[model samples]
Structure formats: C-alpha cells, structure tokens
Target: MKERVQKALDGIADLVWPRICAVGACSRAVDRPGRHICSGCYSTLPFYAPGGACRICGAPVAAKVSHLFTCETCTAAPPCYERTCSVLAYEGVAEELVKAFKYNRATWLAEDFAELAEGAVRAELDSHSVDVVVPVPLHPNRQRQRGYNQSALVARSLARRLNRRMDESSLVRIRDTPKQSLLGGSERRKNLKGAFSVVRPAFVRGRAILLLDDVTTTGSTLAAAAEPLRAAGAAHIWCATIARAASTS
Candidate 1:
C-alpha cells in the first residue's frame, strides 16, 4: 500500500517538476524516463577507451602495445595506486554534468555518474576483491563551503552498486590546500602533501581499497590521497573516477 502511494506521489511530482536534460547546452526534456541525461546528449559524450591507455595511469600511449603496458611516466615514478579506471573523458557533455553535480548542487546526479562508471570499474576490477570503497576526502572547511563532498556522494552510490563497504570517515583531509585545478602537475602534488590523514587505520588495514574520485587530471590528487592509505597498511589500492581530463604529455 505504501509503495503504491509513494509511486503515485512520485508520478505527480515528476509531472509538476519535469526534469530537463543534464547537459547545459542541450536543455531538452529527457527522453528516458527517470534518467538525468538525455539519450542524445549521452550518445555524443566522449567515453574513455582503455585499448591504448597505460594500465597504471589510464593515460593514452602514443604507440599501441601488444599487452598491458605501463607508460614511461608511470614506470619512472610509480603512483601509490596500482591501477586506474575511468568512464568518460572530461569533455563535452560529461564535463558539463560533472560541473553541475560538483559546483551547482545537483546531488541527484551522483547515482547517474555511478551508473556510468560502474561498467568500466567492473571490467577493470573484480568486485568481489575490493574489500572497501573510500572517497577522496575534502577538508572540513571546503566540504562545509560546498555543502557536501561530491566525491563522497558518488562513492556511496558506487559502493551500493558494488556491494562493498564504504569508509567515509577513515580517510580525512587535514589541511585545506589551494585548489588543485589552478596548479600544475608537480605543484598539485606538493600542495596536497601531508594533507590527508587516516583516522582509523584498522578499518582499511590489509584490505583492498577502491579510491573513488570525481575526475582525474594529472592524477596528483589521487596519488596524494592514497599515501596515507598505503602507510596504514592497505593491501592494495585502485583508483576510479567518473571522468579523466586529457593527458597533457
């Protein structure tokens, strides 16, 4: 009885407040019912292909390799995370939707982003092997200023889809550093140095972790966040993101 009532109420609500497509430019009414993005917009979105990408960093390699190959950059100076998986290239529709979700308070887009990222994540990782999911933490001040941690929202939805435990409190950002977007790759790494701390090491100790983030540029933020997790004795760490910016090198 309650389910029926709730469904009816939701139906009425949708009629009163129709959902427009998530793409900023394409303000079309969503073609798929209950979906955030329209089919047309989603079809044009730039999804990432891992065929010629570096296994460790997900960066595109200039030359195709026969087998799983690490890029020269990753081979020279390895990141803390062993591998990375990302769904979309941070461009066009994907970029607009991410900005909306992160900066404009479109929290409902969390589930949509998670849904898009799930297939890529599952293809690259064994869902059964991931013991816990952890979202890259934002400093308390920043989180408060933003009203919510966008990464945490995505992580929760992803954890639900993966059927893994999510430790939102175990990893914390101790320092409120400058915006990573404004800094270069090397500067981004230095800005976040010693910014993260682990509060409950036991929670992630000896457990495989899937670190979730909204996007990846130089991967400095992900690398910095994983430092504390590695020190806390995490068995292994893999990074996943909704989008990845084009590699500069």
Candidate 2:
C-alpha cells in the first residue's frame, strides 16, 4: 500500500513536471513514464540480446562458448581487453542516432542513449563485476574541436545509473591519431598504436575497469587504450560500446 501510494505520487509529480521531449520541441506528448524519448522513437531504437554475443569482443555469435561472445577470430587471437558488451547492432537508426550525437552535438539525445547504455551495463553487472567506468579518451586537440566526447557522455550516464566511480582523468590520449573508420584493420591498429597512456596508475591498480566507447569497428582503438591500463596493473578490463559494425570478413 505504501509502495503503491509512492508510485501514485511519482506519477503525479511527472504529470506536473513533464519531461522535455528528446527529439526537440515539437512538444509531442509522451505517454511513457521516466523516459525523455517519446514512445514512438523509443520503440524504434534497436535492442539486441546481451546474451549470445562474443564474450571477448561483444560481437554477435552463433553459439555460447566458455567466453561470453568469443567468435572464431577472438578464439584464435584474444583481444587486449578481457571482454566487451554492447546494446545495439551498428546499423539503421542506431548508427544515425550515434552519428547525430557525436557530430551534431545532440546533447539532449544523450539522456535517451544513456538510458539504453545503462540497461546494457546493468545486464552485465552481475555476470562481469565492474569496479570503475572509464571513457576512451580523445586527444586534446580533437576534443577541443568537437567540444565534447560522446563516449564520455555515455560513460557518465552509465556511472550515475550503476552507482560506480568514473575516472575521466585516468587515461590520456597522447597523440591525435587519424580516424579509425577510414582505415583498414591493420592501418587502424597502426593509427592508434601507443596513442593512450595511463595518467593515474594508482587509481586503476588492482581494480576491474569498465571501458566505455561509442562504437567499435576493428576495436584497434580500444585495444590501444587497454594496453596502457593493463600495464598500469589494472586487475581486469572489460569494454562496452553502444554499437559494433558486423564483420563481413
């Protein structure tokens, strides 16, 4: 009865306060509670199973191996990060939303994206024990140009929802590397090689860190960041991204 009354009060508060629409103020009415996105747009967002993904790389897999989402490539050659988790496949509306967030500076849309990312993080929390959330760093030059890092926004949202510590200062990007999307796998690896270094080793030492990024194409950038964390004595590192491009090869 007490819980029911509290829920009613919450509903009343929401009605009075009213959430601002995420798609911008056309002022369309939103029926769903506790969501900034309208019901229509929320339904349009893709959701993939957290299970049945490659444990090591977070790619979609045909079967469940001993490692969560370990596909054939990951089985043959392990990635630098121990594992990865992601919410949506990299295609369709997911790709568009991410692009808008990164390039257009759709800061308001982050609320909706964060909700989705937090759901993914929460699903994996029990299975994979995460001690800290670290956003993949951007080079100071690029970050200055972009004005914001989308990965950091996602990380901050996940951290708030999970009640975990976030270390935006731990990893530093030492060089402004070329975009990984434009390069082939080998070139991507070379582009990001030695690009990241640990700034505060003591904070990460003996801790299980959860690295957050917006997307993973070849995962070379993630591996580059993970290498420094590993050297700094991080006990374990897991990665999570909003999207992953399905490998054609």
**lDDT of each residue in 133-244, candidate 2, tens digit only:** 9999999999999999889987887787778888999999999988777788788888888899998999989999989988887677788999999999998888888888
Using TM-score as the measure, the top candidate is 1
Error of 1 at 21 (Å): 0.9
For candidate 1, the per-residue lDDT at 220 reads: 86
For model 1, the local distance difference test gives: 0.87
**Candidate 1 backbone collisions, by pair:** none
Deviating ranges (above 4 Å) for candidate 2: 1-27, 32-35, 62-69, 125-128
TM-score of every candidate = 0.92, 0.82
Error of 2 at 42 (Å): 1.5
Backbone clashes under 3 angstroms, per model: 0, 6
